[model samples]
Target: MVIRLLREQEEETENRGKKGPFFLLIFIIVFLSIFAFVFPFFFGFLYILGFQKVMGCFPCTGQSKKRTESGVNNDIKRKDQKKPTSGSLKVNSNGNLQKEDAAKDDRLSLDARNSNLKDQISENEINGGTKFAFGELVEATDNFSSNCFLGEGGFGKVYKGHLKRLNQVVAIKQLDQNGVQGIREFVVEIVMLSQADHPNLVKLIGYCVEGDQRLLVYEYMPLGSLENHLHDLPPGQKPLDWNTRMRIAAGAAKGLEYLHDKMNPSVIYRDLKCSNILLGEGYHAKLSDFGLAKVGPIGDKTHVSTRVMGTYGYCAPDYAMTGQLTFKSDIYSFGVAFLELITGRKAIVQTKDRGELYLVAWARPMFKDRKNFSRMVDPLLQGQYPSRGLYQALAIAAMCVQEQPTMRPAISDVVMALNYLASQNYDPQTHLAQGPCGSPSRTGAKRDNDKAQIASDGSVRD
Candidate 1:
């Protein structure tokens, strides 16, 4: 034929160029499997429209009104520039709008220092305090009524009202909106009980605050808390007498010697315990909670580092292992509240008798024995104390629980040794007519003239 019909047209043009690259490799494997399944839903819809246009959440049109008028002209050129001072920081470029403008300038400087703390307690005129009206303490606490409560703590509840607009009888308190005290311990217990005068200290006659309420008032007391006449004594009550527990331990050491030698920046009460002392009609004592008062280390600056806080068997083991504090950390929480008025005991107790769970480690081995000082008194004072005034009040509560805070003493020498043991009045019928062998060498020369007038007055050494 023509050359075998031109060899069947050159084998049909080499099988049409090998079936055109096998249909171009099956359309590039179905366009790379539909671009790896629509490239992650179009890059997650352009990363949710660039995170909703960098969080402004873009909805206002005209290009977000020209980007909110160029962010209000860059916040009026950053309020005409030179700003960042309060100890400077200011770095921006949107780190979540610089932490929402540093939490709106710390809530507008803590609402301008809580609106200048009621004009700094009305320009510090404080004395018998005032500022009432939170509807006159809700009509003098009748509203807080549960039969006008009168107890509850950690910074809340207490009641006993009757203030028909200062017709008197106060004591309110309130606070506790999830308590542990706040609003900086209700402005430090109204600026430390309004310039703390002191019949042993608790008076602040008024306070309220209103919106988000607070309250305070005071003056009522009527025989309460010296941990209610020393550790749970209700059923037949009475127990406080050993000359009213050495006159409420010499009026709680003259309210810690008027806050460590009459305050003028000496006040470190920092929550001394025994339910913050209190008591009133006749069993007088006072020092009521100045919400962890602090201000001590003035001038020479011996301590006040701070942040330890108190009451765990009454703190001070070197201010709870070095937070520093001082004024002997309120004389080791007034020697664990004068050893809970000489062992009516309960400064952390839970005893199956394994070395008696801490009342200053069970009075530190009964203060190295003076016949274990009548077995550490307060067996409800049945021996009617005065075994030489219970060995000089357990040697001034063993020099105010000294694990050496410069060996404790000085709250004006624990108010001159508990005001000479509350003027020595223990007449158990003149100590049973001076019976236990009355004049042992004129009672050992009046116990060496009462330890040389308590070591010449500034006692508490060892």
Candidate 2:
């Protein structure tokens, strides 16, 4: 009712635009009052988010959801499900927690698995080279000392090490061997990473598997990750400029495209997030971490079924709810990551809008409303970027993260869209890199003013 009243008043004011300030003021005041009544959800959310710090854990930065994709009753359901009852399930301490931990042994065993990775990679070492031994790695990383550690993850701990033979730095990812799933994840990464080579992809140097230990070695990424650049920087550090942000996004898109149309039996990079995106000195982006990657069939099938596992906000709604994985699934994740890159915000957030609670859901509303879209541009850019570039990039993203899996753009297509968005720059040398970025910026880059041009569609042509 309030919305209808506001709409009618807006129409009246627009019709009365030639009249006067008094008329305008009457219209503005009435519209504001009506909007106040209509958008309480948005305002109430802002009040809680802005003023109420004690409201509990705000999931990520902008994550708020009334209903879960799990289909569990989010609303106050039955008395039985409202709260956990001790009588319903026994809470065992030492025994049960141990079993759960044991089940998670592989997922949690990164530290323990580092010791055995030498044996695993020996079999898969680059065609002809001295097989790396455990003693050599220990020495490279300062005898497995704390100073060499880069970061820890579910697979294992990554350490910076000096390769004696190569005389260069390397990143060693040690995997936990206690769980079979971890072992499987390790094997998949080993086989896939070795064969895959692209400029936008981190190189898989070697592997390590000794008894219950497993590890993955790759060329070290010196500049850390985009996540650190976007969120972890100090106050004085310059945020990623619009050009760098576009480059990073465009490069990552190329990597995804490589896994999609470019590869023989396409691989699905189910996990796409800021942390997995590594940067070189000049802010060149490389997509890494294939632990959750899936190699799927090529052709007319709409999608392939797989377990639903991915980072929270980056996961596509349909794929997360149903275990259907496809090349488009990765596109959806890229879309989320793209939005994060553009906004200089995390995919998750605590914010003023209820639907804006989740970045994607919140972002969709602004896309259709042209005025609202101006707000979507990251505040840091300061109007320096062209609005058309921002809209076109977001439009490509909007296509990627749509609720329908099939409707999502292919990673190859996404690369082209992003390219046009970046600068309409095209290079043949970059294309030979076979990374996703090499794709034509516009799938059908055309001249609008006078003539029609042949659409590149999927193939890049001069």
Q: Tell me the TM-score of each prediction against the true structure.
A: 0.35, 0.62
- Tell me, by TM-score, which candidate is best: 2
lDDT of each: 0.72, 0.68
Q: How would you encode candidate 1's per-residue C-alpha lDDT over 1-462 as one tens digit per residue?
A: 999889988889889988999999999999999999999999999997986677554344334567779867776766745453221245576632222344334221242256455443432333336767777777777788788897988888888888886698888888888988677666767777777788988888867665677777888888778887778786977787687888888898888888877877678887888888898888888988787787788887898887898778888888888898888888878878888898788888886757448787777765664445556667776665566666677678777877888877788877887788889887766553222322222333333223312232224334
Error of 1 at 439 (Å): 6.6
For model 2, the run of ten residues with the poorest summed lDDT: 449-458
Candidate 1 worst ten-residue window by lDDT: 448-457
Q: Which portions of model 1 show Cα errors greater than 4 Å?
A: 11-162, 165-167, 171-183, 187-207, 210-215, 221-242, 247-269, 273-279, 284-287, 293-305, 308-317, 324-331, 336-385, 404-425, 432-462
* Each model's Cα RMSD: 17.6, 32.0
lDDT of 2 by residue, 326-378 (tens): 77778888988998887777888766655436778777766654445456777
